[model samples]
Target: MKNRNDKQGNLPPEIPHKKRFIIFLSVFAFLSVAVLIRYAVLMLRPADTENTGNTKPFVERGPILDRNGRILALQTRLGNITVWRPDIIDRDVLSRDLAPILQIPAETIDARIESSSADFIYLKKQVEQSTLREIENLKAEGRLRGVGVEAIVGRIYPEKRLASQIIGFVGNENNNGLAGIEYALESELSPASVKAKGGSGNQVFLTIDSNVQHILEEIGERIRRESRAEAVMFMAMDPRTGDILGSASLPNFDPNDINSSDDISRMDRPAIWAYEPGSVFKVFSMSALMESGSVNSGTVFVCDGHYERISNRGERVVINCLGAHGRVTIRDIIIKSCNAGAAYAADRLGADAFNELLQNYGFGARTGAGNPGETVGYLSPTSRWSERSKPTIAMGQEIAVSALQMVQAASAVANDGVLVPPRIVSRIVSPKGETIRSYEAPEGRGQSRRILKAETARAMRSYMVDVTSDIGTGWRANIRDLSLAVKTGTAQLIDPKTNAYSPTDFIASCIALLPAESPSLILYLAIIKPKGDSYLGGRIAAPPIREAAEALVDYLGIPRGRNPQISHPGSVSLPLPISPVVDAVVPNLEGYSKRELLPMLLREDLHIEISGDGWVRRQAPPPGSPLNSDTVIILELE
Candidate 1:
């Protein structure tokens, strides 16, 4: 003990001192390196800021923003309130204390605690920070016990029902996306930079504009109410860039109350529901027919209310038209929406060639709109066509399509034959505003796609203009002097029971391209099973779209090609759809536009309080209120 140096000199001869020293140095170096790496990992890991025995604060999931940086979906500061069974002494007292704050019944909370499934259960999930703080303070002060808050991310849709179907909603309190854009962009939306830290996740920028989305929702809701249809599908797109301005399907559910909604109510119809498109198919078929040189602008055919054809299989096919189209050119066929004429035109292109053309036109496939559960649509091979299948499909029947596919196909016509793939999210940005990734199309518009010739697309657009003209079937779609190329359609719904078309059910639809000279926006609208007085596409589907598009033009500040002196230049107010007065004596104000009624707003006899902005969707006093002093009229606009 007195001399350690003397003890080392007396060590066993079998073990060399230098060798032992070398081994000890090597072991020390390895341990030192391992410790340094572990320290670095601990230092670099995300720091949890909450001090109340919680690992992290809520709001780790990134925010979803619209094209202009408006928030759509995001995470809020809320934590899951859980109960530890062992810590809980009196279940009744705990439940009673939480009932008022959590907005849950005491019985429910008590029952959950009593359940034998798990020792611990969430008393309330996703409670605001303020509420959780109060509960924690009470627990710390001995006023409460057993209750704990687990800081976890909570998904919030700020816009409520606006674009709800498109943005979708998360499931439970896990913040896991269950459908739509939420599911489609989970990787981008989920936290990657931090395991469970606030404000560390990336943000997704969509091509949608909140303003545009609100307008579409309003118009689609109005159309649904007027038509008494099951639902309406509406889409708006910037053809040049493949930017989806709006995708709406009504009736939609509010994301804030996701559990209350059904699958049918939350469906993204434009991408999910595929049905026969009726006359809207003519746009694609006619474009293909013209693009293939099978039919030219000058090509003419006579219609006598019927089309007769014989297939290679010795099968005869007969098709009926809405009316006799007489001698018509390609323009006339579209303007009049002549089903027989369209079938004839498709017949001229031959089954194989026409089918190929339509397939290339973006039908029979998904439009790549980036929404989950997108349907590719159904298109039977030409080889499988029956004697009548060709003509039926030619007229927009015997085939299935989604609204997204239709709008994407129509973009080719609007963009001068360029087939830009439809997309929702345009770019992703980090929390610090750094660009992570971008999905926008390149500078050159016509990059890898030319589904139609420039001239052919132009010709098709021109024909659509006639569709909204006075002489065309889409007269209801026409806005006075508004430059728009549009086509309207009405298709019978097929009965699942009989495998035949339902006589009482129909789908009314229309597609429009604004500023017809050089198109910019492509708007498509469709109503399913309209029960309104007029089931025609021109009647039920066109008017609401026309109104919606006009509102869009105003909000977007899209430049009109015409003179500068004009204000509200595109359209005159639409005439009333129904008779305004009950007795036809009160001077009906039912069908007048807001601009047309501004003069009446000055009248003292009638005190009219307008409820909303946009076209007059409804009116009070039955439009027949007797004219008198102090007569208050309530007008509702969409």
Candidate 2:
């Protein structure tokens, strides 16, 4: 009994019901506060933690623009039309309604859905906005059940096929670049996050001018079709700044329909295709010879239709020429394109010195113009030279060079002996038009290195001008009022089976620098494997140079040298004398020549309307009236 009473007392009085409830409330309040604090910490953390995993949030890619701010390639919203077979009530009705909008036959759409192994199938991909709208309207009207549009980010080339090879195309799966500038600058064009460092997915502006590119493409296509050539590559560049204005490769593809094009049609030939440059190489060879002190303007070499050299092993090496240009100086060699003269001049230098000189001209290196698949071309070291290698190379054989290399090398001549590295991209700009980086070097300042002496360049240019003169090989390139320094080449292709020059296959090409004395523009064009009546460079390739030069001279507003003065007869006599206006009244301008109306034309108050050329034959208001604000002085001249 005592123990029971003591134990009950030891419990120390039972807590009040209100106090116990208060204790429970306190413990719950602490837990609630802790949870609130934890949530706040999570909300304050930086978003970078979310990307710690393998997945990343997609960001909008930037656009590709031309130098003039023309949109070439851009990110666009396209929809993939999808269908769920389980949701479909009537397949024929759905296909019929979507056929016209999708530009596909109803039967084709039915077949695609019928042969599907899964419940869902894509009706079409990359559907245009206009077509997507039509489908959406039908869906909203409850016409096509189970049909849906899955929104996706896609690329569209606004210019279509204009510069397809340069712009390239994006892959369907991940929207990654597959080729061209799209692939070359993928990281810059596509960003991982909105807050990416350096610059956000910025706009890539190319040096290519759409207007000039259009002109080159138009001309290249014409030449390709007419000459029946395998392909054609044309390019234009600002020789001083090394900005490639236009690079056109014929047989181009429409990036919008990339699957329709093959490998050959999609190649950027100007920067990638390497071939023997034929007589055009003579320009560089001659320049190298002059720079090495091996030959001068006055040095003369005899050309008896062929160049013959005897090796120490009693081997006779003979190189044939186009013709016998007798007693020819270096100038004559350039004008006539004499292989014998170029070979004899090259004979004066050692193989190592000649190879070094040629390398300095950018023959064996890539121009780095930003095109994918660019080739460095081929130029073996002097140690690999055979007995006839020197003379053969001198005459434009046993060496291969890309079109870009040729353009880069010619820039030295056009820029007065300085070699400027070519650049295709002009700048990287933000989406808001902020300049992030500039690729164009300031005028007269860039990565320029001297390749030839100033005087040597001038001499070479002068000799090249003679090539467009009456007696030279490139005379067909001459323009009426424009002065152009031109070089033409016709190289025979090597047959794979024979391993020798092919008699039927040839590459005809021409290069021109307008305003020979102070050149500003350089244009190069080549027609590969021209199967025409005449494959000679002078006959086929030179004419296109003249044609392009004329268009460029007009488009670029380049000065067309000096025009011949023409004597004009004095002003013709009018039928009647003009009367002077007094007190703000209309004057009798009838029968007065335009020259006599010079003062009246400058009056701000009078609205003068004059038509035709000779003199005022008829005057409105009968030639005598007070001038008013609404009165237009209409003088009909004959």
Candidate 3:
């Protein structure tokens, strides 16, 4: 190395280069170390000081709509008030500050904050955005610490308690369904269900007619008040389509405040509750006896207040009637609701045949209403029947059935012996309004089957028409010039505590098939444990059934010319006006509410993409554009 020192007293250029490199390295290492220290400090910091956690992934859930496109349940963007427990910093001060904002007692807030051991907890959910802004402002001012908020999807029920028992409420645990349609159709309405099928799902449409549902609720409320019963239930269905048009249960709860509702208020009595149907069961029994060729309309029996018979095992069975008739025909027995006469008729039908008929009529099986907690009503097989079983069952006692089951059974009678299975859901549609699938009963289900001869059904209708006459038990149900086949029932309730029938507890019920000649609507009503001046079915349940029928008849326009249903499978009827089918071109959707646009959007041939909220302000290609795969009707809402 020629000389380490530079010439003319200058230092070596290499020395300066090495010194510069060392200095640059020292600076870089120091910067790296500083960065590492800062990162470690952050990792060690307490989470309370940070506004983290409490964020639930925002996934869209489908809406619940009525058959007519009325919104029943929907999801909206809302905020959740969250708090960092450790960061509460000052529990007393924070609770005091939050008390006014949360509209709760400061003591309550204080207790909540002190009870939690978690680093984070939700103070409240579904808080309004405007309300959250106030909280955020207070937190930024250092007045409220350890407080955070998460934007969440909130469920809302616009109809309040209208169909609470049927729609069900969502539980806080993962927002799963707890009961009603919400529970039954959970897989179709849940976020995970949507993901499993695709990215998003179509809305769920129920066959429930909102107007008719309102009518049932109105009439049922009156009956519940007048009878002072423990509870009441009313359900109406279309016998032709098995569509439940209206349903109402007393003591209903508002799903919006489900946490505050009691168990009884949330119960869907029509589908879940079972009771002895009393005289109404006679209708099916008489129909069965007549159809089986065991008895005819002119078949006569003596009822001297009671009927006594000897069992095959030598046991004696005796049943009492409401009144003694010396000689009664099958038609007279029905008109008078004679228990003894019915028992005599049942004796001729034989136990095996009667039980088989009841089972075939769907007595011992669930109505398959697609609802949860439905009881298949108790109908013991002939093998399990006691000596008194036949007579007791003929009088609508000793065997239990739900209101929905009764409706299904009556639908057969009104439908001319063609059993139409009941269905609650109509179809599931994509958000763009295209139908993905229909809920029609598969293969054997929802399909009609001949259960009895049309001639027998007509004779039963004639006897039922007399039931609304002046001397009939269902006299209170008479409407001038309104033709209907009706039956009334009253059975003493079996006290659960004693497992014995209690005289003080009785269920009054009534059923009607309108326009007796060619019935389409079937209405069933029951008042449980009625305590009034009169507890008879005619006095307690008949008038309300008439009122409901009148309202529904007007609402449904039932008097219009109609075709009688066929007994063959896969037969169809035009009982109601069908909604117009969607054409390939876009229809004019202007001046329609967002809710009204839903039915049109549900057309399978249309692709609708909605933007913003509220009514439509602008749309692409107007209303008559020829739709195509690339055609996306851009809807701008204001």
lDDT to native, each model: 0.78, 0.82, 0.80
> Which candidate order results from sorting by lDDT in descending order?
2, 3, 1
Residue pairs whose backbone atoms clash in candidate 3 = 202-429, 433-601, 433-602
Task: Rank candidates by TM-score, best first.
Answer: 2, 3, 1
Off by over 4 Å in 3: 1-57, 81-124, 128-150, 196-199, 441-446, 560-638
Better of 1 and 3 by TM-score: 3
Instruction: Candidate 1: list runs displaced more than 4 Å.
Output: 1-59, 79-124, 128-152, 192-199, 312-314, 442-448, 561-638
Please, what is the TM-score per model? 0.72, 0.76, 0.74
Name the best candidate (by lDDT).
2
Q: Per-residue lDDT of 297-406 in model 1, one digit per residue for the tens?
A: 67888899999877677777889898897887887788888878888887776788888888897788887778999998899998898778877887899999998888
Candidate 2 clashes between residue pairs 3 or more apart in a chain or in different chains: none
Q: CA lDDT of 332 in candidate 3? A: 77
lDDT tens per residue, model 3, 1-638: 55645445777667899999999999999999999998887688775444355544456678888889999988777778888876667888898899989888999888877788877888887776677889989978887888888766678788988878988878774368878888888888876876634444458999899888888988888878877888999999999888998889997888877777998989999989888998988999889989889989668889999989987789888887777877888877877889899988888877887888888889989878777899988988788878888888888998999988888888888877888878788898877788877877433453667798877787788678778766688878877646678999889998889999887999989999987766879999999888856888988889998888878888887762121221222111222212442346665665443333533443445567876544567888787778686777878765
Model 3 shows how many backbone clashes? 3
> Which has the better TM-score: candidate 1, or candidate 2?
2
